[model samples]
Target: MYSSPEQGGLLLSSLCLLSSLLLNTPLCYGGKILVYPVEGSHWVNMKVLIEELYDRGHNITVVRTSTSPYIAEKSPMYTSITIQNDIVFHDFFDSFIEMQIKAQREGASALTFLKLTKDFLSMIGEAHYLSCKVVSQMLDDKEQVKRLQEAEYDLLLTDPAITVGLVLARYLNLPVVLNVRWIASGEGHFAIAPSPLSYIPVSGSGFTDKMTFIQRIQNMLFKSIIMFQQNFVVGPIYEAMCTKYFKDGCDIISLLQEADIWLMRSDFVFDFPRPTMPNVVYIGGFQCKPAQPLPADLEEFVQGAGEHGVVIMSLGTLVNKLPADMTDQIASVFAKLPQKVIWRHLGKPPSTLGNNTLLVNWMPQKDLLGHPQTRAFVAHGGTNGIQEAIYHGTPVLGIPLFFDQYDNLLRLQERGAAKILELAKVNGPSFEQALNQVLTQTSYRENIQRLSSLHRDQPIKPMDSALFWLEYVIRHRGASHLRTSANRMPWYSYHSVDVFLLLLAAGGSVLLTTGLLIRFFWRTCQNSKNKIKKH
Candidate 1:
């Protein structure tokens, strides 16, 4: 017999509460933490966390991505390692590269190719959804299950990139934590940057908040598209490939769905009104200690910016392909600033420069943030950049380019931690004013500092909380308590407004018709009686 949705909800809620309580209680056993890093930042943060955990006497075993050559440069750690081969699709490589060549030759934007790739991947994602049966078959592979069993990890930790790990986690007798590398969403978990876009109901227009019927539908549709792109397109394509190559039989989505905890690499103080899940934690500021000492010249550059010293400007790695005009505009803007600027401009410096501005290829970002005189940040508003600025209690002037950067800056501006200069409109005059506004404003400084303090004051550092919760699940045999409230109900049932309105309309119509019939019959009877008495 199927359990009522209410009972399921109650069961899930009870499980979550019990698991949370158990996790909070100290236990004698602290098991090994298995970490997976797919990107450069992941490698950096995971190394820091693993070392910290190892220092605290936890055994660390790493299931790292083979693609990252940067791991070889890492400092020696006592942790055990098993590097998994990255799942690269040969067909996808051929197709994407061909498209890239065509776009390059035609002078068509790479953005167009990106769109096509995204759409193709999204369709593939949908295919996986439709082929859930095939996924179910793959996940049933016993050999893959045995690998997880053999790892004997007390807890499994993975970056959000390889969601297939999540599926493996479900079969293994260990607690699982997802380390989010970016803004967190439908992972059905919390991380550093909660889905700001997910929660905010985007009603149209400048002033009033009401959305027209059509607009409301459109909003939901658009939001669904975005969610689909993340969950189905990028995420699924990765998982499908992993399942095929690993022969693990487990689809990535299934793995992601099974995660018990979320370690958001973010400072919660920076992100306000975050969506809370049972086991999610924010620890965004963690980074591996830099290998080399800052060069004397770089140190001198930073130190020289004593009183009105540092304005750190960096567009991050991805968006460094800026046009010459934009680069010139940035240099021109910095020349006008009163404070000394330390710029990580990958391109050559503009011919015209004020003595206060210093441009270079790169700077140690975390070290720069640690500096006391570092007043304001000029950033692309990447998630990592935003959290670092917040952790250091520095405000920002965000010149967002694309993707999550737009949403990231919007939240920062809303929180009074930063100001926004749209990519399309940024020029010397506006850029200079933005920098001045961020650097001079007392409120921005105060606001970000207050948030940083709150973030630091959490009962547990996000990393520890993530570890604790994962172990709790393992100890409790997959605590099963932390499942989402949404999982208890079907999709239709979760969206109950349609059912509610339908019932209300039917009941109202019935009541009104009954009342009208009664009135008509009573009048007819009275009229008949009067006629009879007169006769």
Candidate 2:
């Protein structure tokens, strides 16, 4: 008897299902995912990825603090455990703003910038310790530990900057995926990614990918300084916290090495070429989307400029305050521009505010960038702002302040999409010239637009690529096969420096022995010739 086509299709489908089950493949089957995001704007990036996962039918539990309240409580697939009595990050942010403004006022030189950066990083290390302490207290509670243990989470997702998640994963013996929200920092030493000082500029080095001999030397020194900070400064703080919390004498470095994947917030289109392992996934622009409609007032202000267009100026959330003199200088430039200006100002408005300038506490930044009338972007060179500007093909006049801002702008300048205006030298003429150059020059717009196309022309959206990798890790149980052997090797061994030294020693010994034999033979011949002369 002939089987019907429906029966044949059903039989084939059953066979495939049975084969998958027999092989014990997880097949992206959804499971519990626990996420611990770093506080502040960093959360904005993490929220997008988490929501995507939740939409895919995965149960997600986010651990947040009072400082970062759960905003997705309405979602059925998402829940949060808020840690009360936590140190609000806003205080730290305010202190940071004070430090930055003070540095700017003091006319910080390169040396001063390095000093300030070291101090800032040191302060962050202390805060990381405090955050870990609070989380440890909660985790140490017997009831809480029992609840977490019973939860049986299949995967742990967290930002590498926050060590509490690493600690929790260790405590519960779960696999982890680290989401790094900025350019790769700390020399990639801990991450086992190849960071050649010859090309890869350190986070705050203020150097582009193409370096002169002296710049390469400077880059190497900066890398050494970064390593020192990570090991001597940040390492100890994390170690102490991990030891106290887990009581297992765990090292944070080891935990980082064992992470299943690293979702970096960087794209190769904007960054220089560098070697990366399979575990490193570039997910830049994951938070970026097609711009939404602007508010009515914003639309009117932008559209009202006609052909002159408008300029959007923002220095990001962390820098809520600016020095008065600098503000005046900026305002003076804006006043002369025919273009309408939308500035994201903080504290008090500048006395020099002009009729063409519109100052608001907050504006729709991405939407404005995407608007056709946006002639230029004046940014502090934060990664998010730079990425958004690039995504929307807007040219930028970058006034970098601290941390990675210099490096970020340097990369954009190298790509012909931006120009860096030193904050200390923000005069009206220079600012106007720089803004005019970007707005009038066809090259800047063309270059940035080209990059925007490259950024957007991906096989899959960055968010989807990230989600696929996340599920791939879950399906394969930590995906240990993707990890490189270099991750487990010593620094010297990984770089083959030990082998080089061994070869050098062997060659030196052989050369020394050959020299000695030649001298001995020469001495013997001289002695025989002297004896012959005496006879």
Candidate 3:
């Protein structure tokens, strides 16, 4: 069929546009970025972003501690400014993990939960206090402060887990972008967004968005605990830092609320739906991508399983080894499974060790999860691992240990994509049973696959979306317009309690005036009636 001239011109235009899109990159102009990342797993999450920004032709400078375990002093992607660490994160978390393991081994109970919460808060407070000192030291360094000021970077991208970055950004007067899911207070949402205890569950509450009356009470109690931790424990440390640094008073929460963008490490696919702000961008699985080629030996081992496939297990970076007896129990379960097992265990070999299981110090987790031979992921329910599992459509057999792991796993269990076993309840038989159920249940695989589909079906990939928002901020300076006025409002004003109270007072005044007037008229009429009767 021959097209008309007008139609031909339109076709030509469309083709030219397509060519322009495919041939040219979207992020062209590069800008200098200053990164303030937290140590440990948070660094792992932030690294993906730094690398992407680096490849896009941006100059990256990292501020790290002298004793940092993960973020090296030298890197090809970014320059580093190594500063003295008041507290070494590696040692701090190591001891914290040991305490957690000991607590779990004691037993799980209400008291145990509260005690752990207390201990967790204590550790958190110490870390934060030390971090505040570090920031103080950084600012006190006139030479380094001058260096940072002279560089005149476009923005500061931070994890805010430590939150020293917030103060640093404030001092530099740079546009702040947070690669955040957590702050010292709690989950990032509670501080900036409207979080109703009725639906939005506290991080450790284990309640989903739909809460029962009793569950809501429990959530409220948990929320109060977070408030206590924030106000009494962590808040003061940063507040003091703010006081010392700025002659003008500063509130830590205000600094966080004033951030230009929140590149939230969450999306609706993983996190439950809740009220959020305009500056908060959801990029849940931004770090996830197609798996690269596996190492030769790992591929051959995966192939050996043939029809049975592979079950990959890792407890994440924080926990080095499980309790000795618990390790033995888990190893026994792996021994019986027909599927080839790749267990990332650093502990001594279990007495019940089996030939079918490959015990490695570490494995290529992302690549292994993406492989077709992978059947299910045995994980500790860290956000990164769970998101990766969802990305690869792998069902989870979650052994949640400490902090928000249970909550992370709960999301999967709620979706029928996972099974959760308690630390105290995980005997050899129970471990075997849970593993079998995850493997045999067709629905587990199907449900996670559906989530994978949903997560994948987005207008833009999470990474790209995050980058666009970041560059958007750089191009336009701070995104204060997207920030809500509620941040500046006092508690009473924010909830409009003042307005409600004002209306109530007005109503009460009118009622009081009417009642007094009626009483006065009744008395006057009675007096007049008496006088008339007397006459």
lDDT of each: 0.62, 0.81, 0.91
Using lDDT as the yardstick, the better of models 1 and 3 is 3
lDDT order of candidates, best first? 3, 2, 1
How many pairs collide in each candidate, listed in order?
A: 11, 0, 0
Question: RMSD (Cα, Å) of candidate 3?
Answer: 2.3
Better of 2 and 3 by TM-score: 3
Best by TM-score: 3
RMSD of each: 11.2, 4.7, 2.3
Residues 1-535, candidate 2: write the lDDT tens digits. Answer: 3279888888889999999898985467777898887866677678878878988888899887755542444456578877766576677767876777677767968898777867787776777777777678777689988988899999899987766688788888888888884422353333567667787777767888789999999988887777676677667866876767666686656778778888888888888887888888888888788899998878988889999999999998777778887788789889988999999998888888999999999888889999999988999987788889889999999998776788888888999999999877777678888888998899999999998999999988888779888998787768778887776788799779999999999999999999999999999999999999999
What TM-score would you give candidate 3 relative to the actual structure?
0.95
Residue 317 deviation, candidate 1, in Å? 4.1
Residues forming the 10-long window of minimal summed lDDT in candidate 3: 84-93
Please state the error at residue 292 of candidate 3 in Å.
Answer: 2.0
Candidate 3 residue lDDT tens string, 1-535: 4368889888889999999998885554788899999987899989999999999899999988898889999999999988876457778788888888788878878898878888889999998887777778889999989999999999999988888898999999999999999888779998889888889999888889989999999999999999999899998888888888889868779889889999999999988999999999999999998999999999999999999999999999988888888889888889888999999989688998899999999899999999999999999999999999999999999998878899999999999999998877888999999999999989999999999999999998999999999998898888999998878888899888999999999999999999999999999999999999999
| Candidate 3 collision pairs | none
**Cα misplacement distance, residue 196 of candidate 1 (Å):** 11
- Model 1: per-residue Cα lDDT over 155-215, one tens digit each: 7776765354454445454577767744223323322223444343331111112346665
